[model samples]
Target: MTMNKIYSWQHKLWNKLTHHADSGANALLLKGRAGIGKLDFARHFAKFRLCETPSSTSEACGTCLSCGWFEKGGHPDFYHVSPETSANFSGEAAVAVDRDESAGRIKSKKKTSQQISIVQIRALSDFVYMTGHQRGRRIILICPAEAMNAAAANALLKKLEEPPAHVLFILVAHRPQQLPATIRSRCQLINMPMPDVVQATRWLKQQGVNEPEACLAAASFAPLLALTFNDQRYAAQHDAFIEQISASRKINPIELAEKMQQSDLPIVVSWMQKWCYDLLCFCLTGKVRYHLSRMTTIRVLASSIENKALAAFLRTLLVSQQLARHPLNPRLFLEEIFIKYATLLDSNGVKRSS
Candidate 1:
């Protein structure tokens, strides 16, 4: 099928990756934020490589043998490897975010939809080594790249060093730092910018989200995530989380994360991020993005947090985003984060902590 609805930026990225798909480049790190169409870009790029028709700007004529298999997800030559845990989730794009459970929550079922492991890597490698059932190149896609452990990463590296003929590797990640530097260096790095407010708002509208601006502000401009807070379910959750933040400056970020493990992390991060973003606005211009929605709330919250505290708060939030990549102990990290948040806010005279 014609890629009639892809974002413009994705088009440019697709062309860049396509150039290497059929050439000497054996491995490609399709890097980007959760949204910004990274997965769609990769899927379409792989499709183009498998495309029967290769145009200067696009790929796959949609009528060719390659396109048909792709449409059916039955292509013998191509394999998509991602966290088995996230498999059932079918979004236009798939993103990786922090997974939190109580400091000692029940262990995640080693089920197919949770983590990307060495087993999955091994299975794909076996496929890539063997002959393809089709005439085209062999393609393997591993997404949310950070999900792989050291063992899995190394397994992938061994193959990267001695890649099979006609075999292609596409790795996608939200937090590339969690990936081994060796693994990252093996492929071309493509940065997918987070969609701006305008693009995000437009996408939200298309999704039939009411009060798109609230969701946009809630997501801090991340479109793929904007869809989550676009509804009442998420809106109420957002408000509840914010109240938790407002009530206790000593926030247990990891605890919160663990409590809402089955819930969406992007939304949690969005709530926290937008809170700081509002402080940012108030510090800079004394107004929040959605004055009609959360501006009043932010204004009251900001009154308790001056510029110095606001800056520190945002810095901690940024650091928390980085710490989130350490899948080692999500609970401790999150709790400590809120303690620090509470400490900072308390220092500024707000009893936001327990």
Candidate 2:
């Protein structure tokens, strides 16, 4: 769909960006947490910049020829770079490489790469150096810029260093720290804003999402991700996972691991992380963050565990999150974490089943 307007939370940032649209910066880094509409904002800005007749508010004129080309995903001056397995600007998918089996399975029969290769970066040489449609300014949008491998990142760094005239590079990264320091320094870094709970819930309601607050918390306050909580498959899986984990005393780590082996490991680990975070938060501050509906269970569990032990477990989850992406055995990986969690609870006087 065409991005005609920015999100409500983004109006101020939009004004700030448009006010300096002609500042002559060739590259921009739109970095922030995932699912907050940074990509949509970038698309809107690019459309505005390419519009032959922009509005007084610096918005795209939908009727312009440039706007038409952009909406059709065939703009001569617009280029998008993403991992081969990702959806392109036109919503088309491609194949590349498989980094980790346990990181998450793509579900495709053909293995695909999750990285933006050097070839894709080098391919931009033609688009960047060539003449644009009607000789207007060109825009290159690279989303999740951290997905670029070392070679690809270094290649893009060169272009950012000696950027061609009349071209803008917009790099959108959920984890900007993962991007090289040299690459980050070469562009205009824009820290995208996060919508507050009220605004995010309102937006989700406008999108017809029920239980917006709980969903919002489940997604760590990322509205777009919270939207996925409405999906039947994902919701069922997440609910089941949480329910089983809540029964720490009776949870069979091996069985749970087998049941969720097909799921994304990093995501499963994150689910555990959020659950533990809430448990710890309740123990210390008497409040819950993610599992808003499970206050009673969290309260009971929090009282059973020591703050120091829970905090240490939380730190281990951070390391698990990293290795989850490249684990050799997904089942064993899951079993190990679940077992540790059950043991922690058991040690805290939570009786374990035989």
**TM-scores for all predictions:** 0.78, 0.86
Give me the runs in candidate 2 sitting further than 4 Å from their true place. 85-89, 92-110, 322-336, 349-354
Residue 44 alpha-carbon offset, candidate 1, angstroms: 1.1
**Residue by residue across 1-354, what tens digits does model 2's lDDT show?**
225678899999999999888998999999887667788888889889999998897788899899998888778888888766332553333111111221123232323445688998998998877888856588888876877888999999999889898999999887788889999999999999989999999999998888898889888898877877766677777888899999958989999998887666667888899999999999989999898999999988888887898899999998887666446787899999999899888888843332
Q: Tens digits of per-residue lDDT for model 1 on 1-354? A: 123345754656556655666567888886665645566666777777777676765666778887787776667776776664423222222323221211111223332244577877777756776776556477787777776878889998988888788888888787788789998888877787666677768767877888777766655465655566654655566677777776635565666656755433333444576677776787688777633465666676677766776787788777666555343555565566566666756666734342
Among these predictions, the greatest TM-score belongs to 2
Would you list the C-alpha lDDT of every candidate in the order shown? Answer: 0.64, 0.80
lDDT of 1 at 8: 56
lDDT of model 2 at residue 277? 97
Model 1 ranges with Cα > 4 A deviation: 1-5, 15-21, 53-57, 85-114, 193-196, 248-267, 289-292, 306-310, 323-331, 350-354
